[model samples]
Target: MDDLPIIELPEPYRIDEAQLTDQAALPQLMEQRMDAALQQIEQKASLRTDRHIQIMRENMHKYVEDRFQEAIRGSDDNALALVRGELKIRRADHHDSIARSEARVVELVRGILNQYDSATRVRQE
Candidate 1:
C-alpha cells in the first residue's frame, strides 16, 4: 500500500468571497447537495420498483391461466368417476326391473295352470 503514488487531491470547495459573506450561503449549498444526493437515491429506488411491477404484470395472466388449468385437471377424474357410478346404478336398476317382470309372468302362468286343472277335474266327474 505504501508503494501507491502520492495523488494530489483537489480542494474540497470554495465559494466567492461576496457569496460567502451572505448568511444563507452555507444552508443553500447544503440543501443543494442534499437535493442532488436524494435525487440519485430516488432514481435508483424507482428503477427497482418499476422492474418488480413489470415482472408481476407480465406473469399475471399466466398465473391465472395456470390456476384454472389446475382446477380443471384436478376435478376431471372425479367428474368421470361420478358419471361411472351413476351409470352402474342405472344398469342395476334396469336389471332389477327385468327380474321383477319375469317373476310376475311366472306367477300368472301358475294361476292359469291351476284354473285348467280345476276344469279337467270337473270334466272327469
Candidate 2:
C-alpha cells in the first residue's frame, strides 16, 4: 500500500496469509478481496468492450448502407427523410441492443453467484 502513489488503500484490507487463521479476520479479508477482484474484472471488461464498440461503430454504416438504400427505394416516402430516420433509429437500436446484452451478462453473473452461495449454505448445514 505504501509503495503506491498518494493513494492510501484501506489498511484493514491488506492480505496476509498469517491472518487467515484468525476467525475474526475472515469477514474483513473476504470483503477486501472480493471488492478488489470485482474492480479488476470491471477494468478488464471495460478495456475489451471499448475496443469492440469502436470496431462496431466503424463498421456499422458500411455494413447497413446497402440495406438502407434498398429500403429507401421500396418506400414511397421521401428518400432523404427515410435515410435520416433509419440512421438515427438504427444507431439508437444498436446501442440499446448492446446495453441489453451487457445487462444479461450481469444478471447471469448474479444468478450464478446466488446459486453457489445457496449450495454452500446447504452443504454447511
For each candidate, what is the lDDT?
Answer: 0.89, 0.88
Candidate 2 segments whose C-alpha is farther than 4 A from its true place: 1-84
User: What does candidate 2 score on TM?
Assistant: 0.32
Total backbone clashes of candidate 2, pairs 3 or more residues apart or in separate chains = 0
Q: Model 1 clash pairs?
A: none
Lowest summed lDDT across 10 adjacent residues in model 2 is found at 14-23
Q: Write the per-residue lDDT of candidate 2 for residues 1-125, one digit (tens) a residue.
A: 77877756687987666766666788888999999999999999999999999999879976799778877776746767788999999999999999999999999999999999999999999
Clashes by residue pair, model 2? none
lDDT accuracy of residue 125 in candidate 1: 100
The runs of at least 3 residues in candidate 1 whose Cα sits more than 4 Å from the true structure, single-residue gaps closed, are: 1-51, 120-125
List, residue by residue over 46-117, the lDDT tens digit for candidate 1: 999999999998799789899999989879978988989999999999999989999999999998999999
TM-score for all models, in order of appearance: 0.48, 0.32
